[model samples]
Target: MTSDTEEQEDELLALHSIFGSDEFVRDESKSAGELRVCVELPAAFMVALTEGETLSQYEISFLPPLLLTFELPEDYPSSSPPSFTLTCSWLTHTQLSALSAQLTDLYQATGGAVVLFSWAQFLKEDALRFLDIDTLLELPSGEHSTQNCSQDSLDVALSEAKNNKHTPATGPTDIQSLDLSALSLEAEQTLQTSEIKADYQDDQSKQISKEDFLNEGSVLLPSSSSGPLDESEQGAASLPRESPPNEDQRLSGRSLTPSQALLSQILIYDAAQQQKQFATTVFDCGVCFMGLLGMDCVQLLCGHIFCRTCLSQFCKLQITEGNVQGVTCPDADCDAAPTPAQVRSLVGEELFSRYDRLLLQKTLDCMPDVVYCPRHSCGSAVIWDKSSTAAMCTVCAFAFCVTCKKTYHGTEACQKKKKKIMTENDAEQPTAAVPRSQEGMKALWDDYVSGSKQRKRLLESIYGRRSLQNGLVECLSEEWVATNSENCPYCYSSIQKDGGCNVMRCYWCKRLFCWSCFAKLPSQGYLDHFDNGTCNHFGSDFFPAT
Candidate 1:
């Protein structure tokens, strides 16, 4: 079974034991009074939280539909082990109060002692609603084999598929045959090529090369620093390691580039900085500065140093009463609020663990149960009873008569249902099928988005090319508009050229000018003549045409 399913079973077993007897309701065979619980969580809740996901430094809240379960004792008045569930989508103040009351009632009625122990404490936030309910279709117990085979199959498939985009191996080495611990570091590699050789001289040269290379060079992974890098310290990160020694000079007698040499130095520096956030801060001789045999000394902002015991008392007494400002350094006449590091150390491992739990609780304070709608048109509230012979919809009252979602309402009938309805609607819908409207909408949306992106890219390229062309033309031309008046300036007549060239003579005055351009010439004494042009008509050399 999956871990989630196994966890579910464990929770139910815990609830059964908590009720005081294995044979519930005085029946050895029947297990109704055993008080089993099941919770249906969303697929997103599949991930088990990592240690990094938690923040323990402050007051927090949690949101959830996590399923929790407990079994109630049969004999209530004499010896009661009270347990109940409060089902809601969200946690209001009233719901929280009611839950607290239920816990209180369970304790008060049962001689102020917990007869029931909490072996299973947490479930995913959304699964809490069906905590005390039954189920249909229990998951198989073959998850161990399935889980093991899944990784191998995925690795093989990923290795073989040419179309896959994701880098399945995450590194150059093939993961299927790799054993990380057995791999040894290579020492004899030199990156210097002919191109790089031109840039760097041997140690024997006087003046070093000054030109910067445009190449991306080698991958410069972040290395350990003499002091912790500010970004690395924020989130948990390991220190960097040194580069392996170059074997090019030692083994093959190959040359190395200056870039490679610099990279090695950087790696070495980072490796040296690995174990430390900063350099060791040594203090001079003083009675107060002395490290005690039992506990370490923590220095406050006021420069007062004290043992852990002093800080804990200050938080409990001063901070608890909301008078933390009044809390100060225990040393004579100095006052300072306690530092977080000091407070954490003072609290110690046990209290820190508790605080961490509280922090998780606060972060996940009141999330409600959420499940996807099983129907095509509607995503409605549908309870999943895994153990049942068939799934019945509460909202539509449509009953599925088969485990495979086929309705056997006529000839085939399960032990659970008394009345069977045979209809097309009551039959189970295929998992792959989507509602017509949803399918249509999805296609339309996809097409629209894809078309929009292609158009945008096309326009951007066109605009970019035009902009470059415009820049060159702007430099070459003086005034872009009306620089050339393509008409006769003397008579204000339209000009046209019909010949192979631009030169033209006016028909009226036989004026020497370009028929295509009636504007003044940039240089002096450039006469225009054209055999074919509108300006070349019957004309005298000195006469002006009316």
Candidate 2:
């Protein structure tokens, strides 16, 4: 008994080895030693309804994997059967129930032998065939029709098996009796009617074939037939007709019948499948550590596979950071770069536009003769030609000198304009005519006092005394304006007396400014600037007198 148990355990382990550990799970909750296995049905066995067509490759590959939970009994193979449950989300409850019942029937038919592996294989390869499911949408609505059709198919299969004489007679009987009681009376009647029709058609086919062979000599002369051959006879006669003169048919020198066309399509499909199998391979992405199919991954020239998602995200990060040239392979040691097509395919259209723009800008930056428009708001590229020192922006139509980077001066060399500006600036500078001393300082003060009295009288003659006094006060305040008062850096409004702390906000511009240096503060409120060295007066009063 112990040897038998060990053998059963060994068989279960061997099944696990064949399927892989990823597909099998050992359940500890069941003290009886249960195993949970997941199985993905083959693409050919799965079906779906899409766009009014019943022949779609089901989207089961995208759905959750099917799970089979089963427990082994102590004397499983010899006397006791395994206990199991099948779970799937893609199928409806009724479909699952039907499948579960059929699975149980399959196990019972094999008696007390080990049937877990057989059950798994059946569900993976033949579950849809056994369930009479052509498409997932047909499951719920065509239950009655499916029952009748499946019964007819079963009868047909049994008939073929019997005619072959190699199949065991009892096998057909066992299958026929397994679930016949579950079928409704109407379904059974329909199945019988279909069988009778099939038999009549077979007889008619044999009779027609015999008649065609006997009348072959007469058919050679078209005048033998009375009126016109039937549709089937006309089709058969057309097979020997001259081939169409089209280039495609002329290559083979023969026209293909429906059967031949279907066969060629099958051959082409098989070739495509072979190519697909050879091309695709699996690999784990270096960045995200996710398993991805070869088609869904982008392999760098350095031979590292990065999943499309991670590669796109990396490219997007680099492009958004204005590092278009730095969008290379993610590996630190590798310097391989993605091609423009690869980058365009990975990142979407909007981000690719930014990438393209930056790439063009970088290319222009390396050229010595290319300069952008001098306008601050419109910085389109402007190409300088040898004919002229100025370049006109194609986008904004702004013409500028390539040498001085300023508005174009007609027919004047940039060097001459620059020299003239330098000479005029030198002439405007104040000069020290004598040596510096107290006497020179007194002489300057006396000249300033007389100049200011004359300016006050001139201002009073031009305006009124009140306006003159206000202007004079403003001018006097200008001497200590930097130390005593500050202007709002944003709008340059003079802030004479602030009521709040050193971190003052401009009422006119509604922007934060530091009272000490009158520099603008961030919009995130007042306290952030003090910590960042932008403003030093964190706790000081707004207007501390000098």
| Predicted structure with the largest lDDT when compared to the true one | 2
Superposed Cα RMSD, model 1: 40.8
> For each candidate, what is the lDDT?
0.33, 0.50
Model 1 scores what on Cα lDDT? 0.33
Using TM-score as the measure, which candidate wins? 2
lDDT by residue for model 2 (55-167), tens: 33322322223455555666665665555544443354445556666765675677656677787787776766666654342222121111111123447546753555332
TM-score to native of every candidate shown:
0.16, 0.31
lDDT per residue for candidate 1 within 503-534, as digits (tens), equals 45666656655544454332345533334334
Off by over 4 Å in 2: 1-4, 28-63, 135-356, 359-546
